[model samples]
Structures are given as structure tokens and as C-alpha cells.
Target: MRRRNLTLAALAAGGTLAMLPGAAAWSAEGSYPDKPLRLIVGFAPGGGADALTRIIAEGLSKQLGQQVIVENRPGADGVLAAQATSSAKPDGYTLLMGTNTAMVAAPTLRPTPPYDPFKAFTPISSAGQFSMFLVVPASLPAKSVNELLAMVAAKPGAYNSASSNSASELAMLQLLGERKVVNARYKGDMQAMTDLLGGQIHMMFTTGTLAPGFVKEGRIRALATLLPQRSALLPDVPTGGELGLGKLTITPWAGFFGPPGLPQAITDKLSQELQNTLKRPDVHAQLVQQGFEGYGMSPVKFAEFFRAQYEAFGATVRQHNVKFE
Candidate 1:
């Protein structure tokens, strides 16, 4: 869908990807990546994003003939990692496994934004997309989306919903509307899911990558998904549209990015290799098994897609009057 298109229409409208200063020197280099490269992840280890990044990093290492180290720097709903990557050298050695949370939501939600999503980094390529699952502890009385909302309604602000990212946070707000419920923030899905299983929280909007196992094991109950249709990973769970939440469509996605001024040659090489890596039968199979749809785009197209998603998210945040500290 729209995320897969990489916002082509946005690119078509106007604006070019801005390259930071001091990139020309590295752009001309013949041989690049003479050493190991660091791939920064914005979430803690064992989460969906971290798992996906590791999968891609393995394949990327094989493609580039160099080690693609996965580093975790989780904080501020992933702003810490994004900011770290943005300030790093533009030599392509340091890269970010960016998510909509850091790339779009953090900047859109915060009053004094930490960084500009587009200007802080160079778009490398689209990584993949997944849907969010509205999940609750298995022991909860609710079996469907309506039932869960009813429980929250019975005791306003009594039930708490966890959100690890801005997109998930927005999804929760869209569903609740004027309903009173506590919105608890966490650094990553794993942390939130832990509390969800312990009966500490009532509900959350989590990804297929992380929800399927818990749902299958009877640890959590998935009431609905944010996708327009049922997810293959959680076929039994109804979609937001199926539950009369058609407007609750939020596509959770991940992509690759380099620090500002990343050389064009290195960016192109990485993007092409990422595309090739995603197309690999083994890599593709793994990502799918984890509830992710693997895909990639050129740097130019990614730039356009980035702009589109950034603007779209910002507009959504404003329309909802969503705020974050």
C-alpha cells in the first residue's frame, strides 16, 4: 500500500533529498566501506525491530562482504538512536535501521522537535512493513475490540494501554477517541509486552512480528489488527475495519538510512544491495515468517517516500491533537 509505494506521489509533488555539507569528498571515493559497518537499531534487543534488523544485517553482511554490526541504543521512543545516527559521520559506516516511530512520529508529536526526519539523514531504502495487533492479556474478560473498549469505558481511566512507538500511540488514541484510558509509554514492544503478559496493562497496539507467538501460546489475546484485512500471521483476529475501526489504519514500517551527507556512491551501493538482500529467497522467507513483508526502494524513491510519510504523519498528529513530551 501507501507505505510500499514509498510515497511516490509525495516525491512527484515537489522537493529533492537534501544532502548535508562535506559529502562530496566521500562521494568520489573509489573503494568504500574499508572496514566493518555499524547498523544502529532504535529498540532494545529481542524486540521486533531488533529481530528484523538482525535478519537483514546477516544478509547485508553477506552481500557487502563485511560485518554489519547491530547496535542497540533505545530511548525516547527511538529518538536517541535516530539522533545518534544523524550526528554520526556521513561516510556510510554508520547507518540507522529507522522506524516510523523515530523517523516520523517523534518529530511530529514533540513540540520542540529533536530533529527533522528528512534533513537529519540520507534515505537509503525501504526495509519492510507490518501491521499492528490490538492485543490484551489472555486472562482479560474481553474477547473482541468492542468488549475491550467496554471494559475501559466501565471504569474511565481505570484500564491502561501501552504504546512503545508514536504510530502505535496514535492508533490507540484513534480507537479510544474521547474515551478515558491511561496511555502508558514504553521504550520498546518487548518491555510493554512483558507488562501486558503480567496483567499489568489492559491493552496495546503491537506488531505481527511480536504478537503471533504470544497469541499462539495463550499468553495474550489479539482482539483486532490495524490492517485493512486479517493478517496471515494472526488469521483469527479481526481487522480494524472488520471491527468498525476502518479509520484506524496505521501501517508500521522500517527502512534504512545513513547519516546526513552520506556519499551518493555508498548510499546507492547500500540501497541496491539492500534490495538484492530483501529479494533473497532465504531472507524473504525469514522476514515473512516473522510477520514482515520484505521490500526495498531506490534512494531517490525512498527520499520521496520519506517526505510523503513524514508529512502524512505530521498531518495526522495535528488533526488528532496528539502531543508527546
Candidate 2:
């Protein structure tokens, strides 16, 4: 009778274990992404974010032996795509090709951002960084950032600045520097570039891709890059720090993030594959042609970099009192 009782007790415990939730499906190395994965981009097709995501996704697909699709959910400075990513299951099937604007600036620019940048996601690897430059109409005589600022200081509100985005707004505010400069806001880059080219707006902050082509064609001039160090992509243009404008630095980056709670194993695997993909000569050359330098970081390192950047951008955002309307 005692032996029978012991047998029944053991069977009961075994049955309970078998019936417990996820007990049958709790492998740490469970086959992940048996199906195709989705990479969400917060911009329209053919734009920088979309193009970059597709490039990375193509390589990722080859590495993983499964298709990694690029899906565009463009809106709200990447807020829509971020919301989608934050709400996805942490199973590593859905990922975000997030940008500095989507992750860092979104929270600061809006009263209630869709998702918290630091909490809602897990940083994987940084894709690349884009360099921003101070651009002026070709007709302007200011040959350097210092010369241009001196000109703005003298004329004050006489010269107008075309602020195409929030980052540009903050940098332009710093450029104003205890002085007056009329800030003309625009919803997109092309609109502002039109006015600058038409001689209506005298100065603007632009990215490497847009500024260099125009500067080379003699339509506009690049005074200084917003980076602290000069970009190899445009060696002739001095850095803002080198030009004594260190306070106006803005180094925008593109990176990957999975929803919070993503398995560490999956994150590690993805990060490794991504680093390998970025190092490929073909991939590196293509990204460089798109005005990007491949910058891949491991999960832990990317988290540290993300937090540091958050602190830096927060300080700048607070100082500028920048808000989107």
C-alpha cells in the first residue's frame, strides 16, 4: 500500500509538470524564425532608412538562410514603426531598423511618444552613422563656419536659417548663439533646399548625401560637418569641433533593435551575423556609396552607446527647449 501511494504521488507530479504552461516548448535554443522575419523601417520606400534596411536585410537573409523582409510603416518621424516594433512579440521574428530620430528624438519631440526608447527595445548592432554639414547658398561668400557665423552675427535676423528637421533646429539654435536669426521651418528637406537655392534662406544644416553633391555642383557650399571628427567620405570639409563649433555636434546613427525581452541567444546570434554582413567588402562599399560608414556593435556595447547618446541628446534638447508642433 505504501509502495502504491508512492507510485501514484510520482505520477501526479509528472502529470502536473507535463500540463504546465510552456513546459513542452521551453527550449532555450528553440528554432527561431523558422519562417521569414520582418524588418520594419519608419520611412517611405527609396529613402535612406528603407534603402539601408533593405541592404542589411538582404545580407541578413543570406546569412540566416531565411528571407528578412523590409516593411515600411512611415509616419511621425519614425514613431509609427517604433510603436509597431515595441508591441511585437519578443521572439526575434520582428525587428526595427530604428534611427536616431525614431529612437532618441521621438521621445523628446512629442509629449507622449509611442514607446520608450530605452525600455521598449533591445539594441542589437549599430548599422552606420550619417554626417551632417552646415550648408549655404553658392552665392554666399562665407568660406568657413567661423566666417559664416561672423556674417550671421553681424547681420543677425537679416539672414534666415532653414530648419528642415528637429536635429537641424537644435544645431541652428546653437549657431544662433545669443543672437537673432530667423528660423524658417519646413516639413521636408526639398522645400527648404528650394528656398536656400533661390537665395531666400542663407544657411541650412544638411546631411552629407545632399550637401556634397550640391556643393560639388556649385549650387551650395559645405562649411563644416556636425561631427567632431572629419568624415573620410568628405575629407575636405572640416568638422564642427575642428571649426570651434563643438557644442553643435549631431551624429545621427542607424541601428537594429528587437522588442524588449528578446532572448540573449537570439540577440547574440543576430549581432554576430550583422557584424559579418557589414564587414563584407560589397556591403561596405554599397553603404559608403549611400554616404554611410559601417558601424556594428555588440549588444552590450550598443546599449552603452545608446544610453550615452540619450544623455547627450537630452541635454541638447533641454537647452534648446525643442518641441514639435
Residue ranges of candidate 1 with Cα displaced over 4 Å = 1-35, 44-47, 75-77, 137-160, 186-201, 217-219, 227-230, 238-246, 263-265, 288-291
How many steric overlaps does candidate 2 have? 0
Q: How many steric overlaps are in each model, in order? A: 1, 0
Best by lDDT: 1
lDDT of 2 at 300: 94
Model 2, residue 105: displacement in angstroms?
A: 2.2
What TM-score should be assigned to candidate 1? 0.73
Encode model 1's per-residue lDDT on 12-129: one tens digit a residue.
5423322445344344445676789999999899877788899999999998889999999998878999989999989889999998888887787777789977788999999978
For residues 252-276, write the lDDT of model 2, one tens digit per residue.
7788999998878788878988898
What CA root-mean-square deviation does each model show from the true structure? 11.0, 4.8
Q: Give the Cα-based TM-score of candidate 2 against the true structure.
A: 0.86
Pairs with backbone N, CA or C atoms under 3 Å apart (clashes), candidate 2: none
